[model samples]
Target: MASLKSLTKTLGGKDIWMLTLGKGDAESKPAIAVVGGVEGSHLLSVEMALRFAEGIISDHSDVLDNTTFYVFPNMSPDAYEQYFAALKWERSGNARPTDDDRDGRLNEDPFDDLDGNGMITWMRVEDPTGDWITHPADSRIMIKADRSKGEKGMYKVFTEGRDNDLDGTFNEDGEGGIHFRKNLTYEYPYFVAGSGEHSVSELENRALLDMLYTKWNLYGVFTFGPGNNLSSPWRYNRAGASKRVVTSILNDDAGLNKYLSDIYNETVSLKNAPDSGEQGGDFLQWAYFHFGRLSVGTPGWWVPTVKDEEGQAANKDKNREVNFLRWAEQEGLTNYWVDWKEVNHPDFPNQKVEVGGIAPFVMNNPPLAKIGDAARNHTDFIVKMAKMQANVQLVNLKTEAVGKGMTRITVDVYNGGTLPTHTEMGTRSRWLQPVKVELSLGNGQELISGRKIQTLRSLDGDASVQFTWLVKGSGTVKIQAGASHAGVDSQTVNLK
Candidate 1:
């Protein structure tokens, strides 16, 4: 409940751990990693992450030992502070400032809420030659001008602001950090204004790599983010609505793709974003390609409905608006209005100002009123992911008698999960721990030639890990394979 900054230890000082959470334990069950607030403005992410961690501790401690929940609520805490402090420049990055507009001035003239309505509403500048006109069907929603239809443009939309820089630009270069998501190495859109050329703020990325990747036992990973690349609800080629970006990323791994489809209700689609080519820097891609394990990128929240017009046409479909209304009504939130409002804008003093849109406060960032419900819902999903990560498998165990005093034993280990014993991306990027193979023997009188076996690293799902042991005399031997976070399984065989 205290400020995130208050939950840290003295690690050579300077104050940290304000960005991380969860109490660690040694006993293994099913472990889950909860990541949220990668984008600073997404306050709901941080709130829900914390709320779920507490919920698990308070309500589900029985499974706590079996599952270690690693919670990083605010990956960009520095950026979030700007939001709570009412500073207009709250993007994904940390407190570091960048020249957003490249006009030689850096974050000097950011957008501001001149009206003091506590919202960074858009500013409409009335222009005779503007390229946008108010929608006739819904004045609340603006539509691009149709020159063919002889509809003249009326206004230019701008983020709520004045000519702070005096350069005649409304919000060219605001403040605080480039888009961190754009920083991913995966087919990251190049020459983009905000994607940092290099790994600028390595704080969060490095921490994730060091902690999760380095843990050799972390074989499977499910990350929650904005894009639900794995959710394949329907057909492809739907433009911005379809998951074209994720399709190309997993094209090579058809087996894993199929498995993910089954697990995620087949909502996962395979398609690439038309603009950004294939990416090599994305964390999930790196996890699979480099670490040689199963990994997934997921959007934490899903709007139940996809469209209103489509649903109405079918008469049996659900609309995104309906789902939003359900959430709004349930939480008693009235921040969003379908109706239009009349307000004079400095830029477009004559044009009407209507504030009904995506309802940034509710849909974009659910208020604290709904935080508990949201956190509980997501906690279950994370728990399910943990259950799926456990590769508790019995591959093979064989024993044969060679002679009066010699016998041989062999064991085959298989990782049934999509992820192997270690994350491929983690290993490739030097971000994960090497896969570990351990064999334990009970009775030892005369040690044979090959008694102990271990593997430094491992391949991905469906791959077999083999171990062998020789004995001087006929006896029984037990073997166990253990993976971090994935849990452990064992088997025994008798030799003649």
Candidate 2:
């Protein structure tokens, strides 16, 4: 926090911050934002973000010459403190008091650590009509009973607690408020639990959006969260992803997503990854679908699946919990799970109740010791992505004498990077500034062939647009072409 404060101003109070690193010149340059703590439970996300910032400032500051970086680390500090609290649980939300249950009360029924283990685990009640059963391979893990396979239901699972409000639900309402990831506007899941009253209703969400709306130079966004568009691109849904409203990634942007995914796979070598997809009302989707930028996201780390004796990746058919447990055991991690113990429940006086299961924040966050390597790999990937931003340059200059003191100046403006000057959706939305080409003439000189300034909607990778300008009576003229995100380039032409 001290380092960030020394670098940039604190926005939206102490909870939100913005750091801009670059040449600090008048010319607008392309920028990429690295956001962390989109989910409060994922502590590793915050670590990765901070490490990226430190790494760039300490080692890779040269990239800032042409590129600007906006590092927003730890967006959910209020809820993140719960990880170090006396009684810890995987929490996602802010400090604001919320009536999540709609019972006209705030935080009425919070979690209770019944076993005094200082961690909130699961509570299982043995009932004939329950729908959950223990996993066949690992009894510590639970899976829903498959009714179609004639599997008999055995136990009902719930969060560890009693019904504080007598409403027949345990720990339905907690101390934590709105979840930042669940409060975005794009495809907002209305009336959903933890989504808040409306889209962008929270202070952090609105403040971040406000900052982004003013930054016209931002070409891409990278978020460290549960959404994993970086690891695997979303399947194309022509109708849902490409409508005028655009609930899915636009076809062109989807291609970029896949391109970035391939780059990520080549850079990061951790295999047997878990499924990480976009959930509704997430920051990642909102950045692409609504803000109109190339957005990518990932959890940064996941437990690698256990290997078999045949030197092959095992657990192809195993569920996430089962695989995670086996991997944890192989790694000699004993603190991840709490053994089941008998407990008395107020709701079910005569029923057999037990409290135990996988501990919170274990599956999502790896040990702190392993964070450095992951951070370094992710930093390398980000630097590679930065090098791929569209760099517009003016080339192929030619001048001809056309008589009567008139000259024709022609040049090709090209995009030299892998990404386009503007995303397809960005061009269609007309939200991004177009590539503007301007010519500076001498006194009493007038352009006869082309306008003083011309705008192009977009330019694809390795693509160029030709421009010709005829001016009457000019010693020398200057031409400049580019946009905020394309990195402007200028050239001087002589007409003798």
Candidate 1 residue-wise lDDT, 345-423, digit = tens: 5654556654334434345565555445556756665555555554645576777777767667777777676544444
Query: Which pairs clash in model 2?
Result: 241-248
Q: Report the number of backbone clashes for model 1.
A: 34
**RMSD from true fold, candidate 2:** 2.7
| lDDT of each residue in 260-314, candidate 2, tens digit only | 8999989987776667756678888888878888888889999886654465345
TM-scores of the candidates in the order shown = 0.71, 0.95
- Please give the CA lDDT of all the candidate structures: 0.54, 0.84
Report how far residue 308 has shifted in candidate 2, in Å: 5.0
The clash number for model 2 is 1
TM-score of 2: 0.95
- Model 1 TM-score is 0.71
